[model samples]
Every structure is written in C-alpha cells, then in structure tokens.
Target: MTDPVHIVCPHCEAVNRLARERLNDTPVCGKCAKELFVGAPIDVNTARFNKHIERNDIPVLVDFWAEWCGPCKMMAPAYLQAARRLEPRVRLLKVDTEHLQDLAARYNIRSIPTLALFRNGREVARQPGAMDVNGIVSWVDALMRHA
Candidate 1:
C-alpha cells in the first residue's frame, strides 16, 4: 500500500489512519486502543453511521433492517458470515431502521433488508431484500470490480 487509509473505529467511532497492509494485524484504534476491524456487523445509529460512511476510505456495506422484520432476523447469520469474509477490505454495518428512522428516510430505504454499499461518502450500489452469504459476497464482489 502506498498511502495509509482512514478507518473509523467500530467501537468508539474515532478515526484512525493505518497502512493497508496492517489491516490484517488486528489493528487497534490510536485514540481508544480498541480493535479496528472485528469481523462482525457493528450496529449503528445516525451519528455512528455518518462517521463510518463519511470517514472510511474502504467501501462500507450497510444492512438497513428493523427488529420485527422476520426476513431481517433470518438473514442475520448470513450477514455475519459475509462480514467475516468481507472485512479488512470492506466495513460491514447494521442500522435498525426503526431506531434511526431519519437515516432510513435519508437513504430512502423502503425495505427491511436493504444492502447499500458506500464509497467516499456516496452510495455506489444498493440491493433490497434478504440474501444468503454467497449472494452477499457475489453481489459485493461484482460491485467492487466495477468500482
């Protein structure tokens, strides 16, 4: 990697600049000393969601879901699996639409399980519905290739 990338901490939302090669070293935040990428979906509200989308140099994959949505619950494990497979390159997140209705409205998220990929503070691709791990991986991979 030529230049360090900005990574927003999942635990504290503090920004950290790290070399791309160090992403696999279980890097910790400079400010909070918390592990940067934990290989799981971090549930976020509007503030945390804005920090991640606005700060991260890497692509961010967001799962916009609600608590009472049965399909969202069904796809939780698959989203986790996708996180494990996609992290160090992608930042995976979950936003409860019910809790952050403003964010849902801002993104125009009409469905419970919508996957939106953001790069450099702009949405690049979006998919609405529940998906298995393979489906998530392939969809992201295809979008990344074109990005």
Candidate 2:
C-alpha cells in the first residue's frame, strides 16, 4: 500500500492524513467536512500560506500577484482554469503581494503574476509572466514530470 500523505484543508486549515491513491476520490476534510479540493485557488494570507506550504505533503503551486497588476489580472482566469485541472494533486494558492508584502519579499517576487511551484517545502521552479490555460498546465506538467 502507498503511504498516506498529509493534506491541508483549504477550508478549515485542518490537516488530514489520506492515502496517496485516494487524492482524486473527492476527499473531504475531517475537521470541516468540506471538500478538500475545491477546484479553485485558495486565497491565502500570511498565516494560512505558511501553514499550507510548510505542512502539506503534496506539492503546492502559488500565484503571487497584486491587484493593480494588469498581467496578474489577465492570467487570473488561466490560473483558475489550471486550478481545476491541477487540484487533488497540487494545492493551488494565491498570495496578494499588496496585502502580504512580507511574503512577496521573502520569495523575492520581483515580478507580478509570478508562479512558483514548491515541493517538500522548497521552491522547485518559478515562472514569471502571464500565460494562457494551456501554457499554465503544460508548464506545470513538464516541471512536475521531470522534477
């Protein structure tokens, strides 16, 4: 049997130990009784962001953006669509740089609409730019497959 992995609930920020094979089976949170994978990016503040990043056994994809960034707005829909495709495998999160300046600085986010992929609590890859749905999905898939 495969080892169980830790999943941080997007809704309640609760931790759940689930079999790796069951990730795609519409898992729910033990604490909140809410679906773990909501098919959308969870908007995270500093506290929740740290929890998800440091605790989740699975990989995390983070979109660092500001409200005033035009490219960030342009890529929002693509990021949403990518969330639908990547959830249950990757935890998608959005951090608003305006609200969480510390996080942005910590990550060295020199550009808006930056996408960072974290695995095992470390950043594995980063892409800075706006991308369509296909580009977003393909970029993540390629990185994951080779990483």
Candidate 3:
C-alpha cells in the first residue's frame, strides 16, 4: 500500500491522514466527519489558504480572482467543473484578490483570474488568464503528469 497522505478538511479546517489509494474512495475527515472533498473549489482567505497550501500532501490549484473581474466571473463555472474532475488528487481553491490583497501581493498576482499550482507548500506553476473547463483540465493534467 502507498503511504498515508495529509488532507485538510474543507468543511472544518481539520487535517486528516488518509491512504493515498483511498483518496478516490470518498474519505471523510477524522475530526469533523465530513467528506474531505466535495467536487468544488473552496473559497479561502489568507489564513485558511496557508493551512491548505502547507498541510495538504496533495497539490493545490488556486484561482486568484476578484468579484469585480468579468473574466473571473466568466471562468467561475468552468473552474468549478474542473474541480469536479481534479479533486482528491488536487485541492482546488479560490481566493478573492480584492479581499485578500496580502495573498495576491505575496504571490505577485498582478492580474485577476490567475491560476497557480502549488506542490509541497511551494508554487510550481502559474497561468494568468481565463480558460474553459477543457483547457483547465488539460493544463493541470499535463503539469501533474510531468511532475
């Protein structure tokens, strides 16, 4: 069997240890007893963002956006659909740049609708723009394959 991996619960911010293979089996958090993944992006502020990025053994994909951004709004549904496909393997998240300006500045996110991929608590890839579900899936798939 593969090693157990750490997964941060989306519901209650609890950290759970789960077998790597069981990630596809709909695991629940040990603390909150809630399903760890719900097939959608989790909206996080700076504090919660750090916990997920640093504690999750899986990779994370973050959409840095603002409420006023038209492109960000247009891409929201596509991002949610992409999350449905990418979850359990990757933790998908959305951070509002307007509210969490520190996170945006920390990541040097000069544009809204930017996508950042993080692995082992560090950013590994970034894309700036809006994309369809297929494009989002393809981009993440290619990167994860190479990684």
Candidate 4:
C-alpha cells in the first residue's frame, strides 16, 4: 500500500484520508459515505474551494469562470470533457467569480476563463483563455510531466 493522502470530500466538504492505491477504486468518504471522485467538475463555493485546494494531495485544476462571461460559457463543455479525463488523477473544479469574488481576487484571476493548476496548496501554473478538451488535456499533461 502507498501513503495515505488527504482528499477533501466533494459531497460534504469533510477531509478524508485515503490510500494512494485505492484512489481509483471508487472509494467512499469516511464522514459522508459518498463517492469521492464523481468524474466531473465540482462546483465549489468559497468554503469548499478552500478545503479542496488546501487539503487535496492530488493536483487541482480550477476553472475560474463567471456566468455572464461568454468565453467561460463557451469553454464549459470542454471543461466537462477535460474533467472526465482528469479524474481521479486530478480534481477538476469550477469556481464562479461572480459568486466568489474573493477567491477570484485571491487567485489573481483577471480573465474569465483562467485555468489554475494547484498542488500541495500552491499554484504551479495558470493559463488564461478558453481551450478545447484536447488542448486542456495536453496542457495539463505537459504541466504534470514538468511538475
């Protein structure tokens, strides 16, 4: 078995300790008993976003977006497709800038469709703009390799 990793529950926002080997086995949360990785971009408010970014051992890809932004809406489907390919390797998150402006300002998100990659509670790389599924996948893959 590998080391235990801290994985914040996507359902209840409770942090769970999980073995690295079992991350792909459809593990359920210890507190809420809900599936941990649901294979989609989780819509996170401030509290959940903080917990996720700080607690998760795996890398987190956050799409900082707003409902009123055209590029953000245009990239929504691509983000979802990227989500399917990313997890349970990465945690894909959608943060609405309009709802959580503090998070937006904290992350220095000047653009609507900014994609920030975080690991161990620190940002590694950020890309601004809308990218298709393949482009997103390739960008993440390159970053992951370098990281």
Output the lDDT of residue 38, model 1: 92
Which 10 consecutive residues of model 2 have the lowest summed lDDT? 136-145
Comparison by TM-score, 1 against 2, better one: 2
The better candidate by TM-score, 1 or 3, is: 3
lDDT of 2 by residue, 1-147 (tens): 799999999999999999999999999999999999999999999999999999999989999999999999999999999999998889999999999999999999999999999998899999999999999899999998998
Q: Pick the candidate with the highest TM-score.
A: 3
Candidate 4 is scored at a TM of 0.96
Clashing pairs in 4: none
Model 1, 62-135: lDDT tens digits are 99999899999999999999999999899999999999999999999998899999999999999999999999
Please report how far candidate 2 places residue 114 from its true position, in Å: 0.4
Query: After superposition, which runs of candidate 1 have C-alpha atoms over 4 Å from their true positions?
Result: none
Winner on TM-score (2 vs 4): 2
Compute the lDDT for candidate 3: 0.96
Using lDDT, give the best candidate's number: 3
lDDT of 3 by residue, 1-147 (tens): 999899999999999998899999999989989899999999998889999999999999999999999999999999999999998899999999999999999999998899999999999999999999999999999999999
Worst 10 residues of 4 by lDDT: 6-15
TM-score, candidate 3, is 0.99
Estimate the lDDT of model 4.
0.93
